[model samples]
Structures are given as C-alpha cells and as structure tokens.
Target: MDRLEKMLVDIRAFVAEREWEPFHDPKNLAMAVASEAGELLSELRWVKGEDADAHCREPEARRRVADEVADVAITLLMLADRIELDLPAEVHRKLVKNREKYPVEEWRGR
Candidate 1:
C-alpha cells in the first residue's frame, strides 16, 4: 500500500489493539489534536525568534517537539479516518480556498 494508506492502517491497528476505537470519536480526536497542538506551541512559547530556532535545534527540545507533533498528527489522522476523509485531497482543497482568500500577488514580500 501507499505510505499514507499504510500509516492510516497502522493507526487503525494501533487503536484496535488498545480497544481505543470506542473512544476515538470525532470530538475526542479533535480535542486531542488541539491539546497536542497546545503542547507543541508550549515548546516555543518561552523562546523568541532566533532562540526559538535554536531551541528546536537542541536534541532534547527537538525530541519533545517531535513527540508533541506526533500526538497532533495521530489524532488528526484518526479524526480524518473516522470521517472517511481523503486528507491529501482535503489539504489541496483547503490550499485552493486559502489562495483565493490570501492571494500571493497582493501580499507577496509584504
């Protein structure tokens, strides 16, 4: 199978192995995604621009960020799978919508 499909299948198996599908409702997954995103944000909240860049360069800090990001990604994948969404298609669709909302020609380099 393709990488994305395989990832989804793996996530499904992981949840099933834990008997977590019952708790993997849309709202729960959405909340988990938001909570994980907050954790990810917390990693950078205390650091300013240059320092934030350097913080992520540190091994431990980077590992923490990766863990938080993985949490968000896992929840998001579960949510999308629950809703039978074609995530790549949805992302492309959203980008098209966003391009219209924020046209690059109007805001480029500014």
Candidate 2:
C-alpha cells in the first residue's frame, strides 16, 4: 500500500489500542486539528520565510513540526474514517476545484 494508506492503518491501530475512538467525535477532532495547526504556526511566529525554512530543517524543529502535522492528520483521518469519507478522491476533487478557482494564467500575475 501507499504511504498514506499505511499511515492511516497505523493511526487506526493506534486509536484501537488506546480505545480513543469513542472520544474522537467530529467536534473534538476538529478542535484537535485546529489546536495542532496553531502549534505548527507557533513555530514560525515572527519568523521570515528563509528563517522559517531553515528552522524546519533543524532536527528539533523538524520533530516539532512533524508532531503537529501528525496530530492534525490523525484527527482528520479519524474524522474522515468515522464519516466514511474517501480521502484521496476528495483531495483530487478539491484540487480540481482549486484549479478552476485559481487558474494559472489568471493567478500568475499575483
């Protein structure tokens, strides 16, 4: 299987092992996602582009970013799995919508 599928499987196993699924309601998962995103943003607070990129390459910074990213992904995957959402298909659909919304030619100027 692909990396994402493998990761999802691992996440499922993790949740099952901890018996945390019962607490992973949509609202709680959404909050978890937001909280993790905020933590990720905190890493770049007041940092410029180059500095932020450099920070991301540091082992400690990378680990922090990875943790926040995993947290967000886990919550999202749990919510999606609970609701039976097809993640890859939805991602492609959203990409198509985004392409339509921000066509290259029109957006190139900005």
Candidate 3:
C-alpha cells in the first residue's frame, strides 16, 4: 500500500490497541481535531513568518507539532472511517471544488 494508506492502517491499529474507537464518535473526534489544531496554533501565538519556521526547527517544538498534527489526523481519519467516507476521493473532490472556486489564473492573496 501507499504511505497514506499505511499510515491510516497504523492509526487504526493504534486506536484499536488502546480500545479508543468506541469513544471516537464524530462529534468527539471533530472536537479533538479542533483542540489539537489549537495546540498547534499555540506554538505560534507570538511568532511570525521566519520566527515560526525557526520554532519548528527546534527538536522539542518539532516533536510537539508532530504530536498535535498526528492527533488531528487520527481524529479526522477515525471520523471519516466511522462515516464510511473515502478520504482520498473526498480530498480529490474538495480540491476540484476549490480549484473551481479559486482558479490559478484568478488566484491572489496567499
């Protein structure tokens, strides 16, 4: 399987190992995602551009970021799996929609 598939499989196994799947309902998972995202944003509370990049380069800070990112991904994937959603397909569909909304030729303000 590809990297993302492998990661998802591993995440599933990790959740199952902890017997956390039962608690991973859509609402809770979405809340967990938001919390993790908040944690990520916290790292940059007073930082800007180059400073934020430098903060990410530090080992401990990088680990914290990775942990938060993993938490968000785990919650998101669990929610998607619970709803029988095809993540890759949904991602493609969303990208297509976004492309229509903000075409390259008309895109501005990164």
- Best candidate, TM-score-wise? 1
lDDT per residue (tens digit) for residues 41-65 in model 3: 8877888786888899899999988
Find the candidate with the highest lDDT and give its number.
1
Where is model 1 more than 4 Å wrong at Cα?
Answer: none
TM-score of each: 0.94, 0.89, 0.86
Query: What is the C-alpha lDDT profile of model 1 across 27-109, one tens digit per residue?
Result: 98899899999999998996988788789989999999999988889889999999999999999999999999989999799
Models, CA RMSD each:
1.0, 1.5, 1.7
Q: Give the Å error, residue 86, model 2.
A: 0.8
Better of 2 and 3 by TM-score: 2
lDDT of 1: 0.92
How does candidate 3 fare on TM-score?
0.86
Q: Candidate 2 at residue 94, lDDT?
A: 97
lDDT measured at residue 1 in model 3 versus the true structure, 0 to 100: 96
Model 1 poorest 10 in a row by lDDT: 45-54
Task: Write model 2 residue lDDT over 1-110, tens digit each, in one string.
Answer: 99888988999999899999889888988888888889889877888887888889899989989988887788888888878889999999999999999999999979
**Candidates, ranked, TM-score:** 1, 2, 3
